[model samples]
Target: MTFTLATWNINSVRLREGLVAKLLGEEAPDVLCLQECKSPVEKIPLEQFAALGYRHIVARGQKGYNGVAILSKTPLEDVDGRDFAGLNHARHVAARLENGVVIHNCYVPAGGDIPDREANVKFGQKLDYLSEMRDHFRAQRPHKAILVGDLNIAPREDDVWNHKALLKIVSHTPVEVAALAETQEAGRWVDITRQDIPSGNLYSWWSYRSPDWDAADKGRRLDHIWATPDISGAAHSSRVLRAARGWEQPSDHAPVFATFDL
Candidate 1:
């Protein structure tokens, strides 16, 4: 079976329901995973998405903070969610398709501005969250699974707009990159996006603070789609929908896509 999957950090699914609808209406990926939904699962505004033919959904949410969800045209079975770092935040959820393909949708904490964990609690939480992820995958050894989300760390030099400029920045800091790399290594996850489009500066998020986000093109590959190495070769055609960031009232981040012939 072949299906297309895309992941996006919608910021707030309720507030930006229109944009979500627009993407569903236009792009129509077979499965869509969203992070930062910021709404309770019961209040996710599913009717509109259902009307658009994406009737299957599995989500974990909170009142106004981190949330992750998966909406699929294909059937899905709700799997467990994990609260990494022992933070107990609504940041991760999993679902399985009829094809037995498990999808893990996550929203990694954005380590605060300061890189020093001693100076920032959130920064500490981010590192701890990644640490737990590494341990989880190490213990369980996932297979035929895909992990997608706003991981909040850009591990590759070409994944950011400026490597040196962002070296000390939270998302591109050396420590955070090393932590994320360790987690990926533990999981044996292949970055589908980078695997397909290997050479160049690629970004999935642009800061809202930059008024001329497009012209400046200052962005980071904060979001990702990763598959277990066993199935990584089956994945192809990965790309970021950069135009989505230019849409009316768009999220700071854009959607990323990958096609899999499983």
Candidate 2:
């Protein structure tokens, strides 16, 4: 079977349920994984999404903070909700489709302004979370699985608007990039976005702080989609829905997508 998947950080699922519905009604990806939902699981506005034919959902949510959810047009079974680094945040969730394809959705912490651990607790938490992810993947050795999320790290030099200027910045810093690279190596994951689109100033997130985000075009590829090496070859058509950033009250992050023939 062939299927398409999209991953987005909706910021607040409740506040932007309409946008979610609009995407579902329009793009209609077989599976849509969202991060930063900022709502309780039960409070997620699913009626509209369900009405749009997305009957299957697997989510891990917190009242007004980090949350992740996977809504699917086809049936799916919940498999995991991992608290990497033991922070106990609602940051990760996983589900399995009938075709034996497992999707792991995650929202990595946005390491604070200061990347130094001693100076910033959130920064430390972000590093710890990534360390745990590496360790977990090294042990579990996932196969035929795809992982998607607002990883919150722009690892590649071309991923950011200005790599040299942002080198000291949180998301594009060398330490964070190295950490994410280690985690990817542990999982043997293929970065489907770069794999398909190879060269470009690809970005999935534009900071709301920018007054003219579009004209300035200061953005980062903080969101990502990855598949295990075994099934990586089947994946293609990777892209970022850049226009979503210009949507009404849009999330700072846009959606990333990929298709797989399995």
Candidate 3:
């Protein structure tokens, strides 16, 4: 069967509840993986989503930050939310579908304003978190996995609107990019979004600070969907719903999606 999966960093599921429903109605992806929910699991407005036919949900959430959820039309099993490098943040969650496909959703820490780890504790923690991810995936070696989320790092020059200008920026810094690359290599994950749309300037996030976001187009491709080598060929029809960024009080990041014939 062919299934469409999407990943988005909603910023706060509670705040943008309307946009969530709007996205479901418009895009209609079979599985929706969300990050940065910023709400407790109990406050996720489950009934509202259920009314729209998303009956299955697996989530990890805290009070006001760092949450992830996987909402699917298909039943999910073996849901897991584990700490990365003992960070104790609600940043990772995973579930297995009946079709034997595992979906791993993550919201990697956004290293603060400063790019230097020595000057920033958050930056150091971000690097450590990625290191732990690399170690864990290298040891476990997940197969037929679809990993998606706002990884918070733009690894390529094409991922940012102005590579030279954003080189020292938090999300596009060399350290952050190198750490993300290490984790990608350890898991042998193919960046599905980039794989299909390779030769262009692509971005899934535009800062709210921009007055004319669409015209200025100063955006970053912080959100991503990656598939393990075992099912890489099945990955197809990837897209970034840019219009979502223009929605009412929308999240800083947009949805990234891919279709897989698994």
The CA lDDT of each predicted structure is 0.96, 0.95, 0.92
| Span of 10 residues, lowest total lDDT, candidate 3 | 78-87
What lDDT is reached at residue 97 by model 1? Answer: 91
- Give residue 62's lDDT in candidate 1 (0 to 100): 92
For model 1, residues 88-156, the per-residue Cα lDDT tens digits are 899999999999899999899998999999999999999999999999999998999999999999999
> Where does model 3 exceed 4 Å of error?
none
Q: Evaluate model 1: give its TM-score.
A: 0.99
What is candidate 2's CA lDDT for residue 42? 96
Relative to the true structure, candidate 3 has a C-alpha RMSD (angstroms) of 0.8
Name the weakest run of 10 consecutive residues (lDDT summed) in model 1.
79-88
Candidate 2 lDDT by residue in tens digits, 80-135: 99999999899999999999989999999998999899999999999999999999
For each candidate in turn, the TM-score is 0.99, 0.99, 0.98
